[model samples]
Target: MTVAPADDVTGEYLALRTGAGVVADRFEAVWIRGADTTPFLQATLTQDMSGLAAGEITRAFLLTSKGKVRALLWVLVGANEVILLCDKGRQADVLRALVLLNVNMDVTIDAVLGPVIEVIGPTAATVVGSLGYDVQAPHRWAFSEAGHCVAAIGHIRVDLPRFVLIGPSSDVVRNSGGVFVGDLAADAVRIEAGEPQAGRDVDDATLVHEVGALDGAVSFTKGCYLGQEMVERIDARGRVNRRIVGVVVGTNVIPPHGCEVVQGSAVRGRVTSTAESLYLRAPIVLAMVRREVVDGSAVTLTWDGGSAPGTVHELPLDTFASIS
Candidate 1:
């Protein structure tokens, strides 16, 4: 199997870190509309969905009753409708779950089909600003062939400048003055940036806190929604059984997924994603490890019929992490 989703992972990674790269987006869009759009979403999503003026976006979660993540959502409060971004393959599942709980609420949930483009990397803001809008805004939308075009902060960091341009057209991507990076390369960049991909680093079994999404994705002040109780419980507890973390394998080869992360003979956790980090110039892996294994701890990652000693690290990895 390939270590990355792109043929030229190293080049794509370099482009984003140093310059700019227009990444082809694979995420699907969900359009939620009606008079009750604001209140309905306010109750269900983790973000305070009210008072979001037009051209603003908020990261929110649709969670299970047990507080496991159903979907990591990015909500754009538009004029005609409220747009949601969800996992590409599992969008129907997201919509179905939303519809099931949407009783007595005047909201319409539907899937949007089209190509989405993300112009990201350090120079992402420059590329996006040239396209005729402020890259600083959290939520903004335009028009396109497949659907409405939207721009927002691409990832969860302050230092790295990243912006996502979601629309039906590839024209904006071409005109963005950046080399096009595919999903594989984008995945590597995302992993390096500590951005968790749903169904990979996180799943339906994933609690919001496990991936460290409490401050950004889940809202404490918002009214009751599905899975609020569990979220609050986890918040009160202040830690999780296993939290996502970064690992630096001794081997130069990228660690394969499903590799066991062990401390002594007991399996503490497992690696979820790994990549040949261009910035670190070493192989890095993202693992879901028990909370007992503190940062800077030593662990063994067994993969590909061999085992390598790896040092534990915090999220956002090392090379691309903000020092300031």
Candidate 2:
């Protein structure tokens, strides 16, 4: 099916919820191959990479020495090499960081300038299945006859399974009976799922624990890695000053990024992402708010001259699976 235009955000949004939407160029891949690839990654990433068998994938974080997030990655371990997939426009950063950390290790990092297609929504599995690949369990991947790597990445909505097909051909999605969606819809689903985007929902200054998706990306039992000390320190404290939270505005107006979220006179947080949620029929945002702003708290979002009344809620927004 033809992809929806920018104005038709709801068209693409609904397509993904009801069927499938193919999102391309949402991610970039880096191929790392060498005798020391596994050990190199195990020492650099927040996730434990030791004993990661072939055909498995895991979400991991590459952090600065201070425990700030550098890039969120999905490491796909193949027979001879491991592929690191990160948000679009981040391959260079990850590559450079790895190179600096190589030191005496022997590894070759090359950017894979291939087509990255994300098949998302409820029927995403069916679309991939029709293409002759078994719907691999979450965090598992299989190579297609055409050499395209099909990885069953986790979901945005619990019912909406997401798959990433990374390889040379964009034709994999053709005639697959899936709707093509624009970036807006895909981003909305991500916000609704409480998944953070690299430069948008998170950045170099953001800590790994401040985001809600930590349980999957972090390995508390793993050996030391870059930024491990801060992670352990914060884990011991069991709290952070601020965290990424969701704000729902009961109106059509969408707040711009950086709009201040206020409770009375205090500026509690700033909105990092905004979307007109079709599920709630209102505008929603992902914001890094002070920890005291608990769920179900009433708040107001204010910008230069415009303000909208909203309420704070935990990430994923509770109404994700109840689309009507």
How well does candidate 2 match the true structure in TM-score terms? 0.94
lDDT of each: 0.75, 0.84
For residues 1-324, what per-residue lDDT tens digits would candidate 2 score against the true structure? 355665787888987777888888989988989888888888999988887899998889999989999998988997668998899888899988888888787788899888898888778888888777768888799887877888998753354578998874656567787778887788788778877888888899898888766766789997989999999999899998989999999667999999999998999889999987777777899999999899999999999989999988887874446532
- CA shift of 240, model 1, Å: 1.5
Tell me each candidate's RMSD, in Å, in order: 3.6, 2.0
**Best-fitting candidate, scored by TM-score:** 2
The prediction achieving the highest lDDT against the true structure is 2
Q: How displaced is residue 35 in candidate 2, in Å?
A: 1.7
lDDT of 1 by residue, 181-294 (tens): 766566677777787778888898988888784676677886898889998888898778989998877778677788999998888999998777766767888888988889
The deviation in Å at residue 45 for candidate 1 is 1.3
